[model samples]
Target: MKKDITIPVITDVYVAVVNEYNDIYKTQDWNAYIINDKDVDLDMVIIVTDGYSEKKMTSVFRKKLDVLPKKSYAKIELMQEDLFALNNRFKVSFFEGNTMYDKTYVFRKNTINLKALQNIPLMEAKGVLVK
Candidate 1:
Protein backbone atom coordinates (compact mmCIF):
# COMPACT_ATOMS: atom_id res chain seq x y z
CA MET A 1 0.00 0.00 0.00
CA LYS A 2 1.07 3.51 -0.72
CA LYS A 3 0.63 6.41 1.67
CA ASP A 4 -0.77 9.71 0.55
CA ILE A 5 0.10 13.05 2.01
CA THR A 6 -2.00 16.18 1.98
CA ILE A 7 -1.24 19.77 2.69
CA PRO A 8 -3.46 21.43 5.24
CA VAL A 9 -5.82 24.07 3.89
CA ILE A 10 -5.60 27.36 5.68
CA THR A 11 -9.07 28.39 6.77
CA ASP A 12 -8.80 30.92 9.56
CA VAL A 13 -6.60 33.53 7.96
CA TYR A 14 -5.50 34.43 4.44
CA VAL A 15 -3.00 36.80 2.89
CA ALA A 16 -2.86 38.48 -0.50
CA VAL A 17 -0.59 40.72 -2.55
CA VAL A 18 -1.98 43.70 -4.39
CA ASN A 19 0.09 45.40 -7.09
CA GLU A 20 -0.43 48.76 -8.75
CA TYR A 21 1.36 51.12 -11.09
CA ASN A 22 2.16 54.62 -9.90
CA ASP A 23 1.61 57.13 -12.67
CA ILE A 24 3.32 59.96 -10.82
CA TYR A 25 6.44 57.98 -9.96
CA LYS A 26 6.27 55.74 -13.03
CA THR A 27 7.05 52.80 -10.79
CA GLN A 28 5.30 49.83 -9.29
CA ASP A 29 3.70 49.62 -5.86
CA TRP A 30 2.88 46.55 -3.84
CA ASN A 31 0.31 46.22 -1.09
CA ALA A 32 -0.45 43.19 1.02
CA TYR A 33 -3.52 42.21 2.98
CA ILE A 34 -4.41 39.83 5.76
CA ILE A 35 -7.98 38.61 5.98
CA ASN A 36 -9.49 36.88 8.96
CA ASP A 37 -12.38 34.60 8.11
CA LYS A 38 -12.91 32.92 11.44
CA ASP A 39 -14.94 34.25 14.32
CA VAL A 40 -11.87 35.07 16.36
CA ASP A 41 -9.93 38.27 15.89
CA LEU A 42 -6.25 38.18 15.01
CA ASP A 43 -3.78 40.29 16.92
CA MET A 44 -0.15 41.30 16.78
CA VAL A 45 -0.08 40.89 13.02
CA ILE A 46 3.33 41.52 11.55
CA ILE A 47 4.90 41.24 8.12
CA VAL A 48 8.62 40.85 7.73
CA THR A 49 11.08 40.04 5.02
CA ASP A 50 12.64 36.57 5.24
CA GLY A 51 15.82 36.64 3.23
CA TYR A 52 16.70 33.30 1.71
CA SER A 53 18.67 31.29 4.25
CA GLU A 54 21.57 30.66 1.88
CA LYS A 55 21.52 34.10 0.24
CA LYS A 56 23.11 37.38 1.28
CA MET A 57 20.18 39.78 0.77
CA THR A 58 18.69 41.89 3.51
CA SER A 59 15.01 42.64 3.92
CA VAL A 60 14.23 46.26 3.26
CA PHE A 61 10.60 46.16 4.32
CA ARG A 62 8.73 45.64 7.54
CA LYS A 63 5.23 46.51 8.78
CA LYS A 64 3.00 45.78 11.71
CA LEU A 65 -0.72 45.73 12.34
CA ASP A 66 -2.29 45.80 15.78
CA VAL A 67 -5.30 43.74 15.05
CA LEU A 68 -7.41 42.18 12.31
CA PRO A 69 -11.08 41.88 13.14
CA LYS A 70 -13.04 38.85 12.22
CA LYS A 71 -14.37 38.90 8.69
CA SER A 72 -12.23 41.95 7.95
CA TYR A 73 -8.77 42.65 6.59
CA ALA A 74 -5.55 44.49 7.43
CA LYS A 75 -3.51 46.11 4.68
CA ILE A 76 0.09 47.31 4.28
CA GLU A 77 2.13 48.71 1.42
CA LEU A 78 5.33 46.86 0.61
CA MET A 79 8.61 48.19 -0.78
CA GLN A 80 8.43 49.10 -4.47
CA GLU A 81 11.49 47.53 -6.06
CA ASP A 82 12.97 44.07 -6.68
CA LEU A 83 9.83 42.40 -5.38
CA PHE A 84 9.93 39.71 -8.03
CA ALA A 85 13.51 38.66 -7.59
CA LEU A 86 14.54 35.42 -5.99
CA ASN A 87 15.23 35.43 -2.22
CA ASN A 88 12.42 37.94 -1.71
CA ARG A 89 10.25 36.19 0.83
CA PHE A 90 7.39 37.38 3.05
CA LYS A 91 6.53 36.08 6.50
CA VAL A 92 3.37 36.85 8.41
CA SER A 93 2.59 36.12 12.01
CA PHE A 94 -0.50 36.67 14.15
CA PHE A 95 -2.48 35.36 17.07
CA GLU A 96 -6.00 34.03 16.75
CA GLY A 97 -7.95 32.65 19.67
CA ASN A 98 -4.80 32.82 21.72
CA THR A 99 -3.00 30.57 19.25
CA MET A 100 -0.13 31.81 17.16
CA TYR A 101 -0.03 31.34 13.43
CA ASP A 102 2.83 31.95 11.06
CA LYS A 103 3.36 31.40 7.37
CA THR A 104 5.91 32.30 4.71
CA TYR A 105 5.42 32.98 1.03
CA VAL A 106 8.12 33.12 -1.64
CA PHE A 107 7.84 34.98 -4.91
CA ARG A 108 7.67 32.56 -7.77
CA LYS A 109 8.02 34.95 -10.66
CA ASN A 110 8.50 32.24 -13.23
CA THR A 111 5.29 30.53 -12.21
CA ILE A 112 3.44 33.74 -13.01
CA ASN A 113 5.14 34.15 -16.37
CA LEU A 114 2.69 36.31 -18.20
CA LYS A 115 4.56 38.62 -20.55
CA ALA A 116 1.24 40.17 -21.60
CA LEU A 117 0.85 41.68 -18.13
CA GLN A 118 3.74 43.97 -18.94
CA ASN A 119 1.65 45.59 -21.66
CA ILE A 120 -1.48 46.09 -19.63
CA PRO A 121 -2.33 49.39 -18.04
CA LEU A 122 -3.29 47.84 -14.72
CA MET A 123 -2.52 44.38 -13.52
CA GLU A 124 -4.40 43.07 -10.55
CA ALA A 125 -3.47 40.03 -8.50
CA LYS A 126 -6.21 39.81 -5.94
CA GLY A 127 -7.08 37.24 -3.29
CA VAL A 128 -3.88 35.32 -3.88
CA LEU A 129 -2.87 33.36 -0.79
CA VAL A 130 0.39 31.62 0.07
CA LYS A 131 1.64 29.14 -2.52
Candidate 2:
Protein backbone atom coordinates (compact mmCIF):
# COMPACT_ATOMS: atom_id res chain seq x y z
CA MET A 1 0.00 0.00 0.00
CA LYS A 2 1.36 3.46 -0.90
CA LYS A 3 0.84 6.32 1.56
CA ASP A 4 -0.16 9.71 0.22
CA ILE A 5 1.72 12.68 1.61
CA THR A 6 0.02 16.02 2.04
CA ILE A 7 2.02 19.19 1.76
CA PRO A 8 0.88 22.53 3.11
CA VAL A 9 1.20 25.32 0.61
CA ILE A 10 2.18 28.82 1.58
CA THR A 11 0.96 31.70 -0.52
CA ASP A 12 1.55 35.41 -0.57
CA VAL A 13 -1.56 37.14 0.74
CA TYR A 14 -2.74 40.72 0.74
CA VAL A 15 -0.35 43.49 1.79
CA ALA A 16 -0.91 47.03 3.09
CA VAL A 17 1.47 49.98 3.28
CA VAL A 18 0.66 52.58 5.93
CA ASN A 19 1.65 56.22 6.35
CA GLU A 20 0.81 58.70 9.14
CA TYR A 21 0.85 62.47 9.20
CA ASN A 22 1.11 65.08 11.93
CA ASP A 23 -1.97 67.03 13.05
CA ILE A 24 -0.40 70.32 12.00
CA TYR A 25 -1.23 69.74 8.34
CA LYS A 26 -4.08 68.51 6.20
CA THR A 27 -3.68 64.90 5.16
CA GLN A 28 -5.67 65.22 1.98
CA ASP A 29 -3.12 67.50 0.42
CA TRP A 30 -0.13 65.46 1.55
CA ASN A 31 -1.76 62.20 0.54
CA ALA A 32 -3.15 63.39 -2.77
CA TYR A 33 -0.49 61.43 -4.60
CA ILE A 34 -0.87 58.09 -2.80
CA ILE A 35 -4.53 57.83 -1.67
CA ASN A 36 -5.59 56.29 -4.97
CA ASP A 37 -3.19 53.44 -4.31
CA LYS A 38 -3.62 50.73 -1.66
CA ASP A 39 -1.08 52.65 0.40
CA VAL A 40 -2.56 55.07 2.96
CA ASP A 41 -1.42 58.16 4.88
CA LEU A 42 -3.29 59.44 7.94
CA ASP A 43 -3.18 62.50 10.17
CA MET A 44 -2.36 62.43 13.86
CA VAL A 45 -5.91 63.43 14.70
CA ILE A 46 -8.17 60.68 13.42
CA ILE A 47 -11.94 60.75 13.48
CA VAL A 48 -13.74 57.59 14.54
CA THR A 49 -17.30 56.49 13.96
CA ASP A 50 -19.38 53.64 15.36
CA GLY A 51 -19.02 50.11 13.95
CA TYR A 52 -15.99 51.10 11.97
CA SER A 53 -13.28 49.23 13.81
CA GLU A 54 -11.54 48.12 10.66
CA LYS A 55 -11.30 51.62 9.32
CA LYS A 56 -10.14 52.94 12.66
CA MET A 57 -7.25 50.51 13.01
CA THR A 58 -6.28 51.16 9.45
CA SER A 59 -6.19 54.87 10.18
CA VAL A 60 -4.19 54.60 13.39
CA PHE A 61 -1.58 52.39 11.79
CA ARG A 62 -1.17 54.88 9.01
CA LYS A 63 -0.84 57.73 11.49
CA LYS A 64 1.86 55.97 13.44
CA LEU A 65 3.80 55.36 10.28
CA ASP A 66 3.45 58.99 9.26
CA VAL A 67 5.07 60.15 12.47
CA LEU A 68 8.08 57.94 11.83
CA PRO A 69 11.28 59.47 10.48
CA LYS A 70 11.18 60.59 6.90
CA LYS A 71 12.05 58.06 4.17
CA SER A 72 10.50 55.28 6.26
CA TYR A 73 8.01 52.74 5.01
CA ALA A 74 6.32 49.67 6.46
CA LYS A 75 4.73 46.72 4.76
CA ILE A 76 2.26 44.22 6.20
CA GLU A 77 1.33 40.92 4.65
CA LEU A 78 -1.28 38.50 5.93
CA MET A 79 -3.51 35.81 4.58
CA GLN A 80 -7.08 36.87 3.84
CA GLU A 81 -8.40 34.57 6.51
CA ASP A 82 -5.86 35.75 9.06
CA LEU A 83 -6.74 39.37 8.38
CA PHE A 84 -10.45 38.73 8.97
CA ALA A 85 -9.65 36.69 12.06
CA LEU A 86 -7.84 39.71 13.44
CA ASN A 87 -10.82 41.88 12.60
CA ASN A 88 -13.10 39.56 14.55
CA ARG A 89 -10.72 39.55 17.48
CA PHE A 90 -10.82 43.33 17.58
CA LYS A 91 -14.61 43.38 17.41
CA VAL A 92 -14.88 41.84 20.85
CA SER A 93 -14.45 43.72 24.10
CA PHE A 94 -10.91 43.30 25.38
CA PHE A 95 -10.31 46.44 27.40
CA GLU A 96 -11.82 48.42 30.23
CA GLY A 97 -14.77 50.38 28.80
CA ASN A 98 -13.25 49.86 25.38
CA THR A 99 -12.77 47.29 22.66
CA MET A 100 -9.84 46.47 20.43
CA TYR A 101 -11.46 48.82 17.99
CA ASP A 102 -10.56 51.70 20.24
CA LYS A 103 -6.85 50.89 20.01
CA THR A 104 -4.35 50.49 17.23
CA TYR A 105 -4.00 47.05 15.77
CA VAL A 106 -1.23 45.15 17.57
CA PHE A 107 0.85 43.97 14.72
CA ARG A 108 2.72 40.78 15.46
CA LYS A 109 6.40 41.44 16.05
CA ASN A 110 8.64 41.07 12.97
CA THR A 111 5.57 41.07 10.78
CA ILE A 112 6.11 44.62 9.63
CA ASN A 113 8.72 45.20 6.92
CA LEU A 114 10.40 48.57 7.29
CA LYS A 115 12.54 50.21 4.63
CA ALA A 116 13.42 53.57 3.23
CA LEU A 117 10.84 55.04 0.87
CA GLN A 118 12.77 55.43 -2.33
CA ASN A 119 12.10 58.17 -4.83
CA ILE A 120 9.65 56.87 -7.45
CA PRO A 121 9.48 53.61 -5.55
CA LEU A 122 8.33 50.42 -7.21
CA MET A 123 5.10 50.43 -5.24
CA GLU A 124 4.38 53.96 -6.43
CA ALA A 125 4.71 53.00 -10.06
CA LYS A 126 2.92 49.65 -9.80
CA GLY A 127 0.21 50.88 -7.46
CA VAL A 128 0.24 47.41 -5.91
CA LEU A 129 2.54 45.12 -3.96
CA VAL A 130 3.81 42.29 -6.08
CA LYS A 131 4.93 39.17 -4.34
Candidate 1 lDDT for residue 7: 35
Model 2 ranges with Cα > 4 A deviation? 1-5, 20-25, 28-131
> How well is each residue in 11-130 modelled by candidate 1, as lDDT tens digits?
666555555566888976665566676787778988786444345566557888888777776665554445455445777787766667777766554322234133211223433344
The segments of candidate 1 whose C-alpha lies over 4 angstroms from its true place after superposition are 1-10, 21-28, 51-56, 111-128
lDDT of 2 by residue, 47-82 (tens): 121112434334222222222122323332222222
Error of 2 at 97 (Å): 42
Candidate 1 Cα deviation (angstroms), residue 64: 2.1
Which candidate has the top score in TM-score?
1
Every model's TM-score = 0.61, 0.19
Q: What TM-score does candidate 1 reach?
A: 0.61
For model 2, the run of ten residues with the poorest summed lDDT: 88-97
